[model samples]
Target: MAGKLNILFITADQWRGECLSALGHEMVKTPHLDALAADGVLFKRHYANAVPCGPSRASLHTGMYLQNHRSGTNGTPLDARHTNWAKEAAKLGYDPVLFGYTDTSQDPREEDPESPWLLTYEGPLPGIRPVAMMGTWPTPWTDWLKANGYEVPADIRYAYGERAPGPEYEDGAAVPRPLIYPKEADDTSFLTDRVIDYIAESDKPFIAHLSILRPHPPFVAAEPFNAMYDPEAVPGFKRKTTHDEEAAQHPWLEHQLGRKLFRAPAVEKKLRRMKAVYYGLMSEVDEALGKVFAFLKESGRWDDTLIVFTSDHGEQMGDHWLLGKCGYFDASYRIPLIVRDPRKEADTARGTEIDLFTENVDIMPTMLDLIGAEIPVQCDGASLRPFLEGRAPATWRREAHWEYDFRDPADDSAEKRLNLTLHQCTMNIIRDEKFKYVHFTKLPPLLFDLEKDPDEFTNVANDPAYLPVVLDYAQRLLSWRMNHDEQTLTHISLTEDGPVTRRAARY
Candidate 1:
C-alpha cells in the first residue's frame, strides 16, 4: 500500500448541529460520534453556506459560497469550469472514491440534453470516482434488498418509510411506517457494508467520501430502532405553539408556512412520532459509523487517517414549526463539524471544542491543507488546521455567513407565490454571537437578538431601537458579498516572461 495519508470524509444529510450528545443534546444519544469527538476537535458553531442537497454539497466540495459556486438548487447544473475537492485530489495523485452520492447536478453544457444524467440532480460530480452511488432512491441498495429476499416495492421511495408495505397502504399511510426492508438491508447498513468492503480491498491510500442519507427524510427507521425511542419523551419543539404565530413573524415565514413544507401536521402524536423516527435514524447512522471506525482501527489505518464528519445542511425537524431546510433559522443552517487529525501536534487539542464560527466552504480547504495541496484561489474558505493543532488563528472570522437562493429556473413558483421577481427570491444571513440579521432581496429584513430570543421567535427589524444593529449587520453582509467575489483568475497577471501568480494564501 502506498504510504500517503488516507482521507475519510463522511457527511450525514440534514443532521442538526444540536443533535449530538457530545454537544449536550439531551434527546439524542450519539455514542459513536461522541467517541469520535473524544479524539477530534469539534466546531461548536459550524454552519452550511447553502440549502437543500445539491447546492450545499457544491459549497462543501468547491470551498466556495453559494454566490461563487452558483449551483443554487437541486437539479441546477454546477459550472463545469469550477474545480471541486475530488478533481483537485485527483491532480494530487489520490483517486477520490465516493461510496455514496455527492448530489451534484452535472453542467448542461457538458452533457447531451437527452442524457439520463440531465433528467435528475442525483448524478455524481465531475472527477469523482463513484464506487457505489446510493442516493435518494438507491437502485443498488434496492437490488440488494431484492436479493436478500425482501419484497421490493415498485417505487423504491415507498420502501424508504414513505408508505406501509400492505396493499391497503400501498400509496401512502396517514402516518409513516417502518421500512419493508429489515435493519440488515436498510440504506445505512448497506452503505456501511460497502464502505467496509472498499477499505478491506484497498491496498493504496484512499480518499473516501461516504455520504450517509439517513435522518434526512421519510423520517423512518427499521426494527429495533423504530421502537427504540419513546415519542412522549422527545423534547418539545423550539418554536411557537402554533404555525400561524410563526407565520406572523415575516413574509418569508408566511410563504414557507403557506407552502406547507416546513409546517408540521396538526396532530401532536404524529409530529412527536416523526421526531422519534428521526432520532432513531440518527442512532442507526451512528451505529453504522461505529463499524467504519472499527474497520479503520482494526485495519491499522486509524492513526494514519484524517477523519472529517459533518453534514451538508441541517434539517429543521419541527424546529420553528419547520420540517425542511429553508429560511434564515439556525436549525436549517447550523450543522455538526468534527475533525480528528492524527498528527502528534494535535494531541493536546484532542477532545477540545472550538466555538469560533466556521462554514461548510472551509471543509475543502481544511482537507487540502492536511494533504499538502494548494487551496484554489476561487475558494472563500479558510483552513482550520490552526485549531486542530491547539492554536487559534489571530484573525478568525467573528460571524457566520450563509446564503440561500430560492429561485427555480424550471418554474418560478417561489417568485410567483411570494409576489416577487425571479431575482428577488434570494436571501443572505449574517449571524454573530449576540444577533442574527437576515436580508432578503426584496422582502423586508429580519433581525433577532439571539441572546434574548434564542428560539428566534421575535423579529426586530422594524424596531427603531435596534436600527443601529440591523444597519451594522446589513453593511457587513454587503461588504462580505463584495469582498468574496470570484477570484478564479483575478490573482494572475500576464508578464513578458511568464504569468505572475498570487496564490490563494496571499489573498
Candidate 2:
C-alpha cells in the first residue's frame, strides 16, 4: 500500500457466477480463476445492475445505476458529462489502457455527424486508450488469424465460428464442432497476449482493462476445448418441464420466449450441446488467464498489482427456457467477482468468500478507492475496501438490485409486442435472501418466494397470501431508488458567505 497499485481489470463476457470450479460447480472448470479466488476475496452474491453490454458496462465503469446513467439499451449513448473510473484514474497519472472493448455508445452531442463511432455502440470509453480494439468486428483478432496462415471469413464476424473440416455431430446428437483456428490463435489468446506485452513493456505503474470476449456468442470453442465437456453430462436447466409452462409464469416471460433470438433451441440435445460449449469457452478463457497470472508473478509485479476479475453480465444458458441475458431470473443478473489485493492488509481475507450483496456499480468505487482517488459523487455503489481488509461495514445492503430495459428505439419491437411505450418497456428487480420482487414500469409485478421455489417456477404476486410481502418489497424498491437517485450536485448549495458542499457517503 506504499506505492500506487497497478490495476489489472479483466472481464469475460457472458459468464455465469456459479460456473467457477472453486464454487463446487459440477460441470464447468475454471482452474485459473479458482486460483485467483484462492488468493483474493470472492464475492458470492455479486450482480450486474443491467442487462446487455452497453447499459451494464455503463454501470460498471461509472459506478452508477442504470436509472442514473440512463444508457438503457445497447445503442443508447452515455451522457458525456459523467466521469468514469478511466477518466478519474487518468487524473492520478495512470494511462488507463484498454486491451479490448467497453461496449460504450459514444454521445452524439460530443462527436461529429459523420463519425463512424456514431454508427456502432462499440466505441471506447471517453478517457481510455484502446490499444488492441476488439469490438463487434474484431478486426485485430481476425487480422492475426489471417497473418498466421489461417483463412479468414469474408465477413469478419463469422471468424469465431469458422469450423474445422469435419462433420459437426457424432451419431444423431449435436456436438460442439471445433473452430478452424487453434487455441493459440483464438480471440481470448490475442487479448491476453496484448495485455502481457503492454504490461511487460510499460515502465510506469500500469492500469490495464483486459476485456475478453468469450463464452459470449457463437458458442464454438477451439480444438481440445470443444471436446472438453460431454453434452450428456452437463447439468439440466432450471426451467419448467416445457417452454409453454415456463412462459405461463408472466406476460414478459411469454413475450421473451416467443422471440427467436432469446428462445432456447427446441431440441434437447442442441441446448445441451450449447451449454457444454459455453463451459468449454469459459475454461479456454481461464487457460488464457493462467498465462497472464503467471507472467505477472514471474515479472515480480504480482505483489504490487490489484487484480479484479468479473463479468459485465451473466448468461441465461437456457435457464427459464431463455438463452440470453435478460428478464428477472438470477441467472441473467448474477455474475462472478474476485478481487486479489496483493497487500499485507488483505492476507487475512484471502480465500474467504463473502456472501454480502454486491453489484456492478461497486466496481468503480472499489478501484478508485484503492488507487487513492476520490470516488465521484455520482457513484451509487460503495467501495469493497472494508471487505478486502477482512471487515464488513456496520450496515450493508441485504439485497441485490438490477434493471433491464428492452426498448428498441430504431424499431420499437418490444413496445409493439408488449403494448407499452418506450419509457414503459423496463423492469427492475429487488432480490434478497428469501424473496425476489420484479416491478415493471407499466406491466404486472412478479414476486417469488425463493426459499420455497428456488428455481422461480411459480409467481406468488397475485396470491392473496403474498400481497403484503409484494407491497413491502415494492416500497423497498422505491425507497432504494429515491435514496440512490443521482446526487452529483444535490449535496452542493450556494450560501450567502460562500459555496457549501458535502460529499455523498456511499456506504
Candidate 3:
C-alpha cells in the first residue's frame, strides 16, 4: 500500500465519445476499450471544460476552468506560474512523465529570452519528471516521412472544411492511403509503441500521460483501417430539423465549406473522404490502444495501474454544417471520459456508468487524491473518488461549467485596452441539465433547451418565458467564475467616468 501506483493517462485529440463501440456506437469496433470498460468505470456524462485544443488542455492540466487560466485564445499561452497535473504528481515522489503534449497555447510574446513554454510545469511538483515529450505528433509523422524522402503534402497541423492538397503537403502522402501494415506503421501506432516500451521498463512507479494526435484532423488513417468503415454503413447524424428553416440560428455551419478552397466538382467528394478518413483514424487509434492495453496486461500491471482514457475535446463533423469545435454545442464539448481505478480496487468496483455531469477539471484532483497524493485545497475541481468508491455523496454535484471568450475584432486597440483581444471576449456556455446560456459581451446572449431541442435549432435566450431559467444559469455561471478565475490589477484599469475596467475576471 505504501508503494505508489502508476498512472497511464491516454487522451485522443478531438475524439467524440460516441465513436467507440464501448459507448454503443455500433459502427466502430473498439474491443480494447470495451474490455477496459468491463473491468473498470466508464463515465456516461463527461464534458470538456473548453472546446478545441489549447484552452481545453489548459483546463485539464491545471484543474482550472478557462475562466481561471485566462489562456483564453488558441494563441494565448498559459501563464508560466500556473500549476499542472504533472507538476503536482512530482510532488508526491512519483515521476510524472508527459509522453506527449498539453497543447498549451502559444504565448503572444514569442522569442522571449526566457520562454515560459520551454520550461517545466510551474516548476516540478515532486515525484514527477516531465520527460519523453514526443512533441506534437501526426505532424512529426509527416516529418518522419519527409526525413525518409516521401513528399507528403498536407498540413495535418490544422484541418477545416473542403481542404485540398496544399503547399505544406503536396502528394497523397498526407492524403489518405493504405499503409503496408497499419498496426506497425501509423502515427498512432508508433506512439503506442513508445508507451508500451515505457511501461515495460517499469523501473519505478511512473505517471505517464500518453496523449494521441489522431482523430483530430487531416482525417487520414493508415492501411486497411483507411477503408475499414464504409461511409454507407455509418449513418449521417439524424437531422431533427432543416437548417434553412432556422434563419440566424446557426450561420457558422454554412460559412465552413470555404467554397474558395475547393472548386465545383470537389466539394462533395472532399466531404465524403473527410468523414471516411476521420472514422478510419478512429479505428486505427483504437487498434493502437488495444496494443497498449495488451502490454499492460502482459506486464502484470493492468490491475495495479490506474488508467484514464479521455480526449481534450470533440469535433463537429459537418454537424450544424461546422467542421470543428467553434461553438458551445454538445458536439464540441461532450468528450469521452473513463477512469480505471487502480486494480487493487477491482472487487470493490461498483457502478459502470455515471450520469452526473463531470468536467475535465475534476480529473486532476480525482487522480491526485486516488493515488494518495495531496489534492490542492484551493482547486475549484472536486475529486471524484467518492463516486468510484460506490458512494455517491449526497452533495455530489450534477453539472459542469464551460466558457468561450468572443472578442470583437473591430476594436483594434482591444488587446492593449484589456490585455486581450476580441477572440478573448466571447464568454458563453451550456450549463445545468438542459439550458445553454451564451453571454457575448456587447452582443445578445444565446439560450438553448437541450431537452426540448437536442439539435439546438432554437435560440430561446431572448424568450421572456424562459428569462428565469437564463438568469438562474447566469448566476451559476458567475459562481463558477468566482470560484475558478483569478485576475490581477494590471489586467484591469479604471475609465475616466468611473471604475470601468478591462481584465479577465470570473465574477
Per-candidate clashes come to 0, 0, 22
Task: Give per-residue CA lDDT, model 2, range 26-53, as digits (tens).
Answer: 8788999999999999999999999999
- Compute the lDDT of residue 160 as modeled in candidate 1: 70
lDDT for model 1, on a 0 to 1 scale?
0.87
Q: Which digits, one per residue and each the tens of the lDDT, describe model 3 over residues 340-428?
A: 78644544763377788888988898888877776653355778787676767566554766876534344444444435455545656
Best by lDDT: 2
The stretch of ten residues in a row with the least summed lDDT in candidate 2 is 166-175
Stronger candidate by TM-score (1 vs 2):
2
Error of 2 at 114 (Å): 1.0
Looking at candidate 1, the ten consecutive residues that score lowest on lDDT are 167-176
The number of the candidate with the highest TM-score is: 2
On the 0 to 100 scale, the lDDT of residue 290 in model 3 is 83
Where does candidate 1 stray beyond 4 Å? Answer: 1-3, 162-177, 504-507
TM-score of each: 0.95, 0.98, 0.80
lDDT of 3 at 149: 64
lDDT of 3 at 51: 59
- In model 2, state the lDDT of residue 180: 84
Give every collision pair in model 2. Answer: none
